[model samples]
Target chain A: ADVAAAQAASARQDSLTKPPRALGRLEELAIFMAGWQGTPRPVIDRAQALVFAGNHGVCAQGVNPFPQEVTAQMVANFDAGGAAINQLCRASGADLSVIALDLDRPTADITEAPAMSADEVLDAIRRGAGAVDADAQVLVLGEMGIGNSTIAAALAHAVFGGAAADWVGRGTGVDDEGLTRKADVVARAVERHAGIRGAALLAALGGREQAAICGAVLQARALSIPVILDGFICTAATAPLFDADPRLLDHCLVGHASREPGHTRLLHEMGKAPILALDMALGEGSGAAVALGVLRAALECHNGMATFAEAGVAGG
Target chain B: ADVAAAQAASARQDSLTKPPRALGRLEELAIFMAGWQGTPRPVIDRAQALVFAGNHGVCAQGVNPFPQEVTAQMVANFDAGGAAINQLCRASGADLSVIALDLDRPTADITEAPAMSADEVLDAIRRGAGAVDADAQVLVLGEMGIGNSTIAAALAHAVFGGAAADWVGRGTGVDDEGLTRKADVVARAVERHAGIRGAALLAALGGREQAAICGAVLQARALSIPVILDGFICTAATAPLFDADPRLLDHCLVGHASREPGHTRLLHEMGKAPILALDMALGEGSGAAVALGVLRAALECHNGMATFAEAGVAGG
Candidate 1:
């Protein structure tokens, strides 16, 4: 972070007419962006939402009501500008693209063995990262995958060392029976990979899209491009990144808190708070897309608002 | 409330690809608006933020650091497009207007007696309601007055029967002594105006700007135009209306929960939850101005999003 830019933002904030901190976290977000952009004023001229669509092997265990084909269907829906994320992008003036990663090549069910080999996870991450436009000022990470929440819960349980049931939730319309089956799948995954950790743990329990998100976040930070994180499956992918480098979150904003039980724990682990808390459970970066308006509005205030001296108002 | 329109919105929601209530309260808001607008796709075409500037009598109590002069100065800032709310309106494509209501004449010190004559309060409300253009599609209620939170606290305390301290909070910036003084002021006002309720309570404790906001909200509802409520002072002004007609709130959306303690109790009283909780406290309808973007975006999604059949995606 650029301390000089952040300090400058604080100084400018002090000159606003309202009492210091009246803007609350909105002020903090602006200051953080100012520092990250190395300017007292920062703007988001172009934004993109990258949807990583994949399929999970855990669906074989009847974890979710939807068939694996739903992932491919949602990807097509996104391409046709008919998905939730599509309308959100149109509303926020952000571009939307679907990354159709492998869908038929489901990995070994987490309850039985390691989900994916390390090479595969790393390769998927790199592919995910390469798909992003380096010129885009900001990115919103989203995912569309059938039964991916199952992988998310399993991964979180392994890394966070929680009871599997505590981390699992009824994702995408899972009934009580389906919920129990998902929890059982996660519990067995934890037992199957009891001692794994770090990158190894990621490869052991993560799904294709989850690995891609982890990879893309790492790439975005390396490129100094900010990313907005969506709901649970996407957030769970960050567990390994948090383990690798906590500061990686400096380049990200939590769009909204997901209703998924694991997402709340995952956010707690990241030590980040969401900008919106609408209990939004639908993925495809819908929450982050809605938040794009808020973030852009923050930048507008940061750049367009006048200081007390300029406004001829009393300083805070 | 238009039950037929609401039913249509619900039917349309069921046809969307997401599961029932997957978007949380956001979906509900769109549905409500669709019903109220008598269209499946209700949109806010023209929005306005009405900032009612006035002087508070309780400023004499040293309840805040800023003097009453700041209210007029901020109104000038609003006219110059220099305030936070001005930037917010510009970002959201909403019009901003500054109403220079009588400010030199502060209300009677509420700790001792009534703030304004019943006629003056009612006239202020009428004046406020008239300021809103009939052509405006939506209104965002805001206020500009130092120590107005004291008036808000007093009004809420008298109407809601809470302890004075529960309703009192730092308005602009208050020291520990000032906070205690503000709370003491509220306590005294609550005791002084014991059993005063409804329109009578408003005249007894409300500031000029507070009364106007109340009037504007009521007028908006009468015109079938929706309002987005800002922070405590503006929101507290509506307590009597809530007591009189709970249906009036069907036309309002609580933009964000203010940092003030009473705003929570006030929203709880209104039986509504804020769309955003940014902890924003500086009012010029700033929170509501920001919410205009979300509201517009919601309309965009409702209008542009394709249903499951249209998108050729599987139903929920």
Candidate 2:
């Protein structure tokens, strides 16, 4: 991060027409952007939103309510501009793309074995990283997979050293019986993959979409493009990176606390506060896309509003 | 409010490509807008934002940090498109207007006498109501006044039966001493005006800007335009109306929960949850303007997303 630029932005915030710190987190958001963009006044002219979709083998355990084909169908819907993320990205001025991560192939069910081979995980990550636009100022990451929430729960439990039930949640409107089965699947998967850690743990319990999110986040950081992470699935997908190094997420913000119970717990474990908490649990970069509006508003006020001296307004 | 339209919108939400309630409060927001707009698909093509500025005699008690002239100066800044609200409104696509409510004449010190007589309060309300745009789809309300936070605190304490210390806060960055003196002033004012209720209570402790907010909110309801209220001062201004009729704020949304200590308590008292809580305390309709972006996103998804059958996606 550009510390000097962040300091400059903070100094400018004190000079704004409003009272000092009156904009609260907005002031922090603008300064954070300034640091990442290496300028006291940062603007997001190109925001790239990427949604990675893959079918999960965990569906064999009946953890998800939706069919595996729904993942590919949602990608088509995204292309047709008929999904929530599409509307949100359009409203927030983000250019969005959906990448289907070998949807015709499903990872091995985690309950039986590792979700993917190390090489397969690496390839998925490379695809995610390659999809990021070099010219984009910021990246928004989300995911689509039928049983990815189960994958997310297993990954989170393994990385955070928590009970499987603590990380499991009803994804996509699962019933009470489905919820119990989902928890059991998570427990069995974590136990089967015991002692696996870091990237190996991810390969053992994560989905292709999850691995891709990790790649996209890392790629954005490498290009000095700040990232906005979507809900539970997206966050859990990056948990292994955070496990390796907490500072890996310094350039990212969790967009919203999802209604999925595990998301808030996961966010708490990561020591990150989401920008929005409107109970939104939908993935596909929708939460991050909606939060892009707030980031835009922050930067607009930072760069557009007159200083107290310029406005001839007395400061307290 | 059109119940049929709201019901239709809710039903449409269930049919969207995503799982049920995956959009969470965004779904509720769209349905609420539908009810107010009397359409299953609501759109906010024209949003009007108003900032009311007034001078406060409460400043006489040394309760404020800035000079009373600052209110008028900020109004000038707003008119010149150089203030925070101007930038926020521009970013959120809202038409911005500033009304200086007789800033040349400060209201009587609430600790000494009622802030305004019945006639003066009524005139201010009329002016506030007259400022609303009939064709606007939504109204955003905010305020500007030196010591108006004290006015808000006093009004809240009187209406909610709270201790003066509970309502008083360091508005616009007052010091520990200023805060103590402000709380004392509130106690004295509320004690002197004990037993006043409803609109009379507003006149007893509220500034012209506060009363104007009540009028504007009522005017929006009359025109069937949904309202988004700014921070503490705006909410406190409309508290008396809420006290008069709990249903008075049925068309309104608290845009954000302000960092001001009283604001959260007041919101809890009113049983209203703000759409955003970014720790914002700048009450120039800035918070409300930012929240308008979320409302816009909600409606966009509600009106634009393809249904399950349309997307050929399986529903849970």
Candidate 3:
């Protein structure tokens, strides 16, 4: 962490006219942004979202309401700029890129076997890492995959240390039967992959989009870029990174706490609070895209406003 | 209520590719915007915030930690664009207006006497209402005051029918002793005005800015202008308006649920929900200003997004 920059930002914060800690979390976020950017003044002036679209074999287990092809259909919608994330990104002045990392093929059913071979998992991570824009300061990682929440649940159960009931949620609003089936699939996958951990556990129970998201998160951290995470699916994808190195989370921010039950559980584990609480559950980085507005606002306040010394306002 | 426009907006929402009510409150807000704006395609393109600054006599009861002069000081901060609301307004592209309605003197101690005479209260309301801008489409109401939480708690307890303890909280992080004292003061004020209701209760217990905010809410409704409400103090001031005509709520949107305890109680009394839950209590329209971002996003998606028919995507 850039302690010197954080110190400078804090000094500015205390010099503001209001009482100490008058701005609350908003001020804390500014200091955090300063340290992350390694500057007393930081901005999310240039932001980009990468949508990693893929498919989950758990769809074969009758785990979701939508067909697997709907993933491709949604990807097309993102491509044509018609989806929720597209509108949010466009409205908030963030660039959007939809990448079909592995669109045509679904992962192997994790309940019976590993989702991908070790080599494929590594390649998926590389592909995810490769998509981060070198110039963008804030990188938002979102995903579009049908029945992927079940895989996310399995992954969360493995690395994040939660029961299937806690990890599984009404993904895409599954019916009662679908919910039961999804839980069963997650339970079986967790038990089958009990001995695995880290990248091996991710490869055993995670989706291609999830693995790629994991890679993107690591790459962004390595490049000293701050990452904004979407809801349950994306959070589940990055669970391995957070579990392995808690310090890596200093580079991550939760865009919103989704209505997905497992999302709160995961957020609790990460000890990172979301910037917005909009009850949004439609992933594909929709929460993160919407949150770009708050991020930009925080930056503007941190960098643009006059301090008590400058405004000639008395301190309390 | 612009029934035709609302129905048209709802039709567009249904025609979108997502499941019915899949977008949840986001779609509801869009439809609500259409009804309020009298157009199927509604946008909060031009928004403004009016911050009414006043002082509370409740400070004499040792109900707060800060001196009353801080209210005037904060007003200067608002004018110089150094306060939280100013920075938020600048960041979100909202016009900011700070009115020192009655800051030179504090309100009368509520436990011993009425905060304002009936004529003064009526005049305060008129001043609040007169600040509305006809050119603006979305109007946000916020306030600045010291020891105002005591008066707000009293107003909420008297108007919204809640226990004084239930309505009281630490404003600006008051110590435990200050909170207990504030509660005692609110309890006494509620007892003193036990027989009064509506405008009489407000005039007896409210600060000048609260009365003005009450006037602004009514004026916005009379002009068919949509209002975005700030936290506890403003809500307490306008409680009487909400009680008199619950239908007026159709034109108002709660910006966020303030950390102030009375805010949730008052919101429940009005049967309204906030757009965001940022846990902010800075007042001065700060919550409303940050919320401008969410409102703009909702409007953008409502007016600019393509439907299944427009995008040629399959219906779910």
Best by DockQ: 2
Q: For residue A195, what is the lDDT in candidate 1? A: 83
lDDT of 3: 0.81
Per-residue lDDT of model 2, residues A1-316, tens digit only? 9999999999999999999999998899999999999999999999999999998898998887777889889999999999999999999999998999999999999999888998999999999999999999989998998899999998899989778888878788889999889989999999998887776776898889988988898898899999999999999999889888889999999899999999999999999999999999899989999999999999988998899889999873
Name the lDDT of candidate 1: 0.82
For each model in turn, which proportion of the native inter-chain contacts is also found? 0.74, 0.88, 0.41
The best candidate by lDDT is: 2
Ranking by TM-score: 2, 1, 3
Model 1 over residues B210-240: C-alpha lDDT tens digits? 7888888878877777788887877887877
Better of 2 and 3 by lDDT: 2
Worst 10 residues of 3 chain B by lDDT: B16-25
TM values, all candidates: 0.97, 0.99, 0.95
Which prediction has more favorable lDDT, 1 or 2? 2
Residue A239, model 3, lDDT: 77
Q: Model 2 off-target regions past 4 Å?
A: none
**DockQ of predictions, in order shown:** 0.75, 0.90, 0.53
Better of 1 and 2 by DockQ: 2
Error of 1 at B292 (Å): 2.2
Tell me which residue pairs clash in candidate 2: none
* DockQ leaderboard ranking: 2, 1, 3
